[model samples]
Target: MFAPQGPTLRELAVQALSSVERGYDLLAPKFDRTPFRTPDAVLAPVSRALRELGPFDSGLDLCCGTGAGMGVLRQVCRERVTGVDISAGMLAAGRARAGVTATAPRVEWVRADARALPFGPVFDLAVSFGAFGHFLPRERPELFAQVHSVLRPGGRFVFPIAAPARPGSLGYWTLLAFDAAMRVRNALWHPSFVMYYRTFRLADVRAELTRTGFDVELQSLPELGRRPDGSPRCRLVVATRAR
Candidate 1:
């Protein structure tokens, strides 16, 4: 669901037909107006979680579309904050919205692919918002490795993950349908825009993080409440690079 200021149906159609980077570039200006942006509610708890673990220095926001995660970094990291994304248009929008005026933690916007981050081990913490679905399951290891490579030892790669919906629930069918449609789109389209809701399983993700040399931990975000079976509805996955 989109707001009145969000992308129109025709605009969304044009984006859906383009490459992922191009599509996001087209959508950048109105992205925060759409449901696609990471909610502030989610951001708040993640910030709180990081605060308990931090007092960190330089931080990086991976796949930082419009810099939602950058806000979280600003609160935690004292030295500098960087937002890395592939889309120039998205980076432009992020710079505009994030108000990087050179007085603050020295926000830097780098146009780079997340799979091949250019920075060295310069960050004490790294955060990503709602960007993982753009990466396929097979790509998780490399993605995690890139984050690991950029983070100093004992640094963390943190993000939120909502619990998978129950089989018969509306949320389940919606994601299933969305992922199925994406599969069909990729099958017929060029330069496939890989966004799949069902493929990013927690078990698989934890395994990939482990393989990438992260000591992974999952902490429930109680603000999102719990499922009928009493399991947390949302969780923050904190993957720390070993010292």
Candidate 2:
């Protein structure tokens, strides 16, 4: 659901029909007002976890739309901080944020694809938030490799994952319908908008990370609390490249 200040139905419709880049460009101005922006509730817990594991130097926010994870990086990383994404409009939106502009460490915004990052092994930490749906399962290996390439030997790439929705729950049906609609939309549309909520599974992701040279670990984030099954509702994935 969108706020009153968010894009209207017609505006959202036009965006959904456009290429991913163009759609985001059209939506970027009001993106923070939409449900798509990473919420503070999620960001706060992940930030606390990163702080405990870090005191890291040069940091990177991969697929950093509107720089939510960059804020998390600023809390843990003492040196250079950078946010990279493919959409110029999204980067501009991030640049205009008061928090980003006043960050203590130097901040850089790069417009680049995550599948083919244009940086060397320079970062000590890399974090992403609420952007994985944009990447298909087939693209994930290369994307992981690209993140691997940018970090120093012992650097980390981290992100949070919520437990799968219960089979008969409202959340599960909602995501199921959303993914089905997206599949239909992609089948009929050109320059398809590639976002599907149900595609990124924990088991598959952990396997791929292990295959991509990361020493993978998962830590429960108690700050977010647990599910009815007594499992953590959310867990942080810490995948560190070997030194």
Candidate 3:
């Protein structure tokens, strides 16, 4: 769902047809008004979890389109917060709307691909929100490695992951249909808009994070509620760089 000021159907269609970078550029100004933005409900609980795990110094928000996760980083990290993304438009939108108070840490924005992040191991905390679908499964190793490379020893790479929809459920079919449509679209389209809903499985991702040198743990976010099976609706993946 979108607000009245959000991108129109025609605009969304145009964005779907463009390359990922250009599409986000066209959509950036209206992004926070769309359902695509990470909601406060998710961010709040993740921030609480990070606060318990932290008292951290420098933080990084990887693939931080419009910097929703930067707010979370600002809460738990004391010194500085940096948001990095591949889209200049997204970074510009985030910068315009940052509204940082004087008490908060210094905030910086950089335009760079997540597969090859530009920072050294200077961060004590790193967070990403709702941006992984842009990466293919095969690209997970490189992506995880880049995050690992940017974090200091014992620093964390954190993000939330929802439980998969139950098989035969409406949510399950919806994600399946979306991924199938994306595969078909990429097959026919140029520049390959790479968003897909179903390819980032938890088990596979956990294995990749481990192979990339993170000590992985999962923390349940109770505020998001639980499924009928008593499983958490969402869990934070807390992957620490090896000390």
Candidate 4:
């Protein structure tokens, strides 16, 4: 669902046909108006969880679209915050919205690919929001490694992941249909826009994080409540760089 200020159907169609970076560029200004932006509900619990885990100095928001995660980092990190994204348009919107002043923790925006981060051991905390679906399952290792590379020893890479839908549920069918449609679109289109709804699995992600040298833990976001089975409706994956 989108707000009155969000992109029109035609604009969304155009974005879907473009490459990921260019698509995001076109969608940047209206991104926060769409449901695709990380919900403040999720961000709040994640920030609370991170605070319990840290008094971190520096933070990085990987794939920081319009810098929503940067707000969370600002609350948990003490010294500086950096937002790295590949879309120039997104970075521009982020810079405008962030309004980071000299009084706040120094905020920097870098236009760079997440698969090849430019920083090294420079961050004590990192957070990504609603961006993993852009990468294919096979690319997980490299992406996780990139985040690992940028973090200091004992640094954390945190993000919220929702519980998977049951097989016969409406949510399951919706995700399946969305992924199928995306596959069809990618097959028919050029410079493929690679946003899928169901590619990132928590178990697989945890294993990949471990392989990338992170000590993984899952923290239930109880504020979001629980499913009928009693499992958390959402969780925060806290992947810490080995000390």
Candidate 5:
């Protein structure tokens, strides 16, 4: 659900039809008003978890659209925070919201492809929020590798993973239809916009992270609560670089 200040239905339709980069460009100004932005509820708990992990220095926010996750990084990181994304519009929006001064542990933005991140092994922590759907299953290896390459030895890459939408639920059907529609659109369009809600499966992603040499751990986010079956609704995937 979107607020009154958010993009209108027509604006959303236009964005949906455009390439991912262009769509985000058109939507950047109003993105926070929309439901697409990661909420504070999610970020707060994640930040707390990262604090428990603690003492991280430089941090990177991969695909850091509007830098919502920068709040999480800034809280837990003792040094600087960097946000990387492909969309200049989104980066500009993030810069405006971030309001970083010219000081230590300051915020900086980098425009780069997530698959081909442009950075040295200079970060001790990396995080992504609600951006994985843009990547296909096969692309996870390279993306994970890119994140792995930027982190310092014994560094961490972390993010929260929601439980898969249960079969026959409205959420399940909605995601299914969205992905199906995106597939058809990509099949017919040029410079195809790739965003699917269901492509990032937990098991496959865990395996890929393992292959990329991370020691993976899934810790329950109790604040997000559990499901009817008493399983955690959300889990934080904490992947540390193997020394």
Candidate 6:
């Protein structure tokens, strides 16, 4: 759901019809007001988790739309933080929102595709939030490889993954319907907007990370709570580049 200041239904309809990049560009100004933006509740737990795993320097916020993960990187990383994204409008919004103080680490915004990151093995940590759905399952290998290439050996690529909604639940049906509609839209439209909720399975993601040279670890985010089945509601994927 969107807040009072969020994009209107007309605006959203226009965005949904546009290319992913153009759609996001149109939404950038009011993205934080939408449910699509990573919530602070999620960010707080992730930041706490990163703090436990860190004392890290030089962090990267991959696909950093409006820089939500950049806030987490600021708390965990000591030296520099970079927010890389393909959307120039989103980057512009993030830059405007980011009020850099002298005390905080250096922050830079780079416009680049996540599948082909333009950097060496420089970052000690990399994190992404709410942007994976834009990448199709087939593109994940290249995406993971790019993350691996940018991270220093032993550096982590961290992101949170909530447990899938239970079968027959409202959440489950909602995501299923959303993905189905997206598939139909893409099938009929040119310059397909690629976003599918059901595609990023944890098992498959772990396997891909392993194949891409990451030693993967999953940490439960206790602050986010647990499901009735006693499984964690959310977990952080900390994938360290092995070499």
Task: Write model 6 residue lDDT over 37-139, tens digit each, in one string.
Answer: 8999999999998999997999999999999999999999899999999999999999999975788589999999998899999999999998899998999
Q: How many residue pairs of model 2 clash at the backbone?
A: 0
Model 6 lDDT, residue 179, Cα: 98
Error of 5 at 25 (Å): 1.0
Count of steric clashes across candidates, in order? 0, 0, 0, 0, 0, 0
Q: Which runs in model 6 stand beyond 4 Å of their true positions?
A: none
Residue-by-residue lDDT tens digits, candidate 4, 67-101: 89999999988899999999999999999997758
Give a tens-digit lDDT track for model 3, residues 1-243.
Answer: 899999999999999999999999999999999999999999999999999999999999999999999999999989999999999999999999996578868899999999998889999999999999999999999999999998999999999999999999999999999999989999999888999878888899999999999999999999999999999999999999995
- Give the per-residue Cα lDDT of candidate 3 at 148: 93
In model 3, which runs have C-alpha deviations exceeding 4 angstroms? none
TM-score (C-alpha, index-matched) for candidate 5: 0.97
Q: Could you tell me the TM-score of candidate 1?
A: 0.97
Q: 2 or 6, which is superior by TM-score?
A: 6
Screening candidate 4 with a backbone cut-off below 3 angstroms (N, C-alpha, C), the clashing residue pairs are none
Candidate 2 stretches greater than 4 Å from native: 99-103
Scored against the true structure, residue 107 in model 2 reaches a CA lDDT of 93
Consecutive 10-residue window with the lowest summed lDDT within model 1: 98-107
Residue-level error in angstroms, candidate 6, position 125: 0.1
TM-score of each: 0.97, 0.97, 0.98, 0.98, 0.97, 0.98
Provide the lowest-lDDT 10-residue window in model 5: 98-107
Cα RMSD to the true fold for all candidates: 1.0, 1.2, 0.9, 0.9, 1.0, 0.8
